[model samples]
Target: MSDRQTPLLGPDVFARRQERLRQELITRKLDLFIAAPSTNFQYFAGYNPGRSERLIAVFVPAKGGSVIVCPSFEVERLTRNAAVQDIRGWEEQEDPWRLVRTALGEMKPQHGRAELALEHTFDYASYLRLAGVGGDWHIQTAQPVSERLRIIKYPEEIALIRQAIAITEASIAATFAALQVGMTEREVAGRLSEEMRSRGAPGGGLVQFGPSSALPHGGPGGPKLAREMVVLIDAGSPVEGYASDITRTIWWGDAPSEEFKRVFNTVHDAQTAAMQFGKPFTTRCQEMDRTARKVIADAGYGLFFTHRLGHGMGMDGHEVPYLVEGNETRLEPGMVFTVEPGIYQIGKFGVRIEDDCLMTETGLEVLSHRVAKL
Candidate 1:
């Protein structure tokens, strides 16, 4: 568990974020940046307005103040949590896109084809309606702007993720202690969920046993855990929007096969080598994946290791800076991601060991505690 206490981010933090993004907007030569009711909304606006068919959004200009648009009925509720004062609420029958156009008019002088960056969560229907709003608007992805800021963690964000990982690790440990033979995967998953919530976590995680472990993302149900079967638990709990992800595979029975032990060790070593790599803030993302993949392939189980080494984790479980083949993004400090290397033998068993890792000035800091042993 982290010694740092996770506290609520204050208005100052959001203000800093908004200012930073505005600079990014100017750098990208964009006119305006719009965020829907997604993580980006929660990120910049300091609250979530909840997702609906209604076109609720936050509009930030490249050089001026921001505004929010939501249903007129929701104005009061949104006001309580939002820092933006210029809240424009439309009635049920009103054209919300017109309101968006009005907000744009107040933002900047409309040059030729004013470029607008839309948060990726907006549906195609929303995009079409937005495009129809006219004013020579050009809608492009907000990826470069959003991903650049979010990919790097502030110290507070790291603390929150650590707290979340502590909760999930404790919940998984508690759940396994109470496990017994013949328990359905759903029952076990339910118990895990209960454990996490009881410990103040937002939710539970994934559980699999025996052949189900081979599926990687297998749902929990139908399978009954038996002695000598492999047990896999992949979980993440969020703390104040930051996320934690961890996966641990273990042999359930007292008697374990030699092959299982060997596979487990191979995965453990692969993850270790990848984590301990001495590169500092400049190693290509795929280079890290290759480092781990080589270890698995050397053990003659490369074919079974089908998936990427890991993915970036933050407000979303899977985000930018993916540690996989072909991605060339360089790893930088404050970036957090998972280093999970797994080998699955179809219809038989699989082994995976994952740890939430933070890249540092020196090396990777393993955030989650390693609980499973050979």
Candidate 2:
């Protein structure tokens, strides 16, 4: 169907990832890291069984091998692709929390006063169960440790993300070419979805038009496309487990008003400024946001730019190293993220341009570049 190549990550990559995570755990002074069924677990284990009422987790001890705990029926399925060898299965009637505790006890015999970091996705009930397992253990969020590891991309990971971006760009181009003045927002979104899926994307994302485009993260079912309306399409595709997120806004027909051109140019200039400012070892994450915000603010459209400048993009569309106020994480080589600056005027129109960028040893490398012109 699709001409794109799907690269496979070998066992060596998984081994290295585990080693890095274990090292990070030690550095963070955490004894054990527990991950529920989430992107973090999939990142390590290479298997993504959807989350459910039943408990499924990967337990990584600071000193030793990782283990997965899941339902009995899923043991075989999980083992087929998961890199971790030790998988403990719980019967439907058994309490999985006890099994998890047993596994942790085996991994660390001196469990008393142990420090454990739980992935953020764990449900409250699961958290309480695991918290009750050992009375003296310290429990905290695993975000710091996990986010640190996932924020940096491996070469193979970047390749997958690139493939996804390529597919997404093609899909958006097709949607734009096929769009008509009378087409509904839903119809345009459907066309975008068709193009993406036809190109082997797992799914399609958002497409908004006209006044609805003024709302960030707007849904479909809005008014039909009209002449001189702003069209905004924010969509992405997943390649392997990595993701590609991009957004582009355009005027449907004829030249837009001078005000619209000014806003567009301001947003474009803001994105350019952010990209120019993003450099490895030098640019703090929030600095990118500030640089972009300054451009819009100076142009007198500061209040219209409603959201943060950007966010980290990888396995999850939005992740660590967020480009927003209060985040002081410095950019580093191998880190990938989005630099999207927008101007949304409620009841009127919106304009946003996003590009996925990789922080390289030299500087920022823009990954999604097909739709650069506004």
Candidate 3:
């Protein structure tokens, strides 16, 4: 069982979030920001009413308070949990889009400035209805506004992430200790999942053994674990809506081959170099990617080092402020992300070392220290 404590978010937190979103709307020149049934909606509404063919939305107007429009059956659940006072519901036969239109019209948005921003997860069919009802109001993606607020970690969120990481590490350690040679990749993955769930994790993640590790996202049913073969386990779990992601590659039974040792060391060094370069307010997000990529490229494994160096982590396993090429977003204090550099050789083996890190005033702080040594 995990000894780490999970932090709780109260109504005040949601209130502050709504206020911040309202401020962002004004600053970004958006008239109405709409979040459907997704993380963005949960971030403000304090609950996820789930997604469906029916329309469920939260409208945050720039000049006034927010409102939630859901099916009549869900109104009571939302009312109990959501911070927003305005709750509008529609019955089975009624058109929910009309309710959304009524809510938007009530906002009294000026025609020329009636710009609507919808979350990326908003369904396309609903978008059509909302767009038609919105008349001449401009429609755009709300990712910028919502991602801006979610990329930075609050203290409570960090606490949950820490607990998730601890639980994930403990489960991985247990799984590794119980692993036996000749076990199938699926068997090992099942054991890992059971261990993680037992340790209070919501679920487990990827597990690849032997040559299957060569595929970055290798499917199950690959070769069995054997002596001197590489084993890669990339797993995580949720702690109170927050998430933890980590990847560790290890040799199975006996000592690894010289080539395996060299590749592992190179990948490890790349991850270290990237983390060291991730300073707040100074380093661009892509710099971390470049730093790690350069290390692998210099080691003559450039082509093998496919995919981005890492990605941001939070309520969702992967989010904004991605550590990849062409992302110019500057790192800031309270920003958290992963630093994972890997090399994949088809029909051979792969090595990946991933860890979570938080950007602080002084520098970057690594959050997961369980599998630092290969």
TM-score of 1: 0.96
Assess candidate 1 and give its lDDT: 0.85
Q: Each candidate: what lDDT?
A: 0.85, 0.86, 0.86
| Cα deviation of 84, candidate 1, in Å | 1.8
Clash list (residue pairs), candidate 3:
none
Instruction: Give the Cα error of residue 43 in candidate 1, in Å.
Output: 1.0
TM-score of each: 0.96, 0.95, 0.95
Candidate 3 lDDT over residue span 298-367, tens digit each = 9999999998998889988999779999999999988988888999999998999999999989999999
For residues 1-374, could you state the per-residue lDDT of candidate 1 as single tens digits?
11112238877887888988999998989878998887888778777766888889999888889899999998997777776778989999988888987887777555556788999999899888888874577789998899999999988888888999999899888888888999988898899889888988777778999888988888876479888888998888888778889888888989889989999999998988888772766788899899999999999999999999999998889988799999998888989999899999989888889899888878778899864456
Q: How many clashes in each candidate? A: 0, 0, 0
C-alpha RMSD values across all candidates: 3.2, 2.8, 3.0
Off by over 4 Å in 3: 1-7, 370-374
- Runs of candidate 2 exceeding 4 Å displacement: 1-7, 109-112, 370-374
RMSD of 2: 2.8
